[model samples]
Target: AMFESNMLETKQREIVINDIDPDALEKLILYAYEGRLEIHQDNVTNVLRAAHLFNISEIVDSCCKYIEKQ
Candidate 1:
């Protein structure tokens, strides 16, 4: 949604996400392109939150499944 908004037409064309952890954001980016992600005990919560914030249902479901299995 950020990219779809007018922000992309701005001079910088950059979307700064300050609420999410940098590591989680990195993992989310990796998942977006790779279609795969590793959700470990330490990062599952962070990943889930980021995925939900971005409305990435696949990752959110995966994270929930991982949590249920734990």
Candidate 2:
């Protein structure tokens, strides 16, 4: 595995932020950073999409559990 010093790498972390609005993306980043999230019911789908995209497995599962419990 060769990680060059300067070249851009496609093997970087899989975070698909392009599908989200900028403000919501910022919020998601903050949640991942701080472990505290303030999400609305309307935005659950967006959050689930982000969690799935970023390979945050636990978050995706938790969202599923929460939805099932609702």
TM-score of each: 0.82, 0.60
Clashes of each: 0, 0
Candidate 1, residues 1-70, lDDT tens digits: the string is: 5446676545465657778988888898998789669789999999999999989999999999999999
Highest-TM-score candidate: 1
Question: What residue pairs are clashing in model 2?
Answer: none
Candidate 2 structure quality by residue, lDDT tens digits, 1-70: 2345543454676534467666556657877899866566666667777777767776677667767767
Per-residue error (Å), model 1, residue 11: 2.7
The alpha-carbon deviation from the true structure for residue 52 of candidate 2, after best TM-score superposition, in angstroms, is 0.2
Screening candidate 1 with a backbone cut-off below 3 angstroms (N, C-alpha, C), the clashing residue pairs are none
Stretches of candidate 2 off by over 4 Å are 1-16
Best by lDDT: 1
lDDT of each: 0.86, 0.67
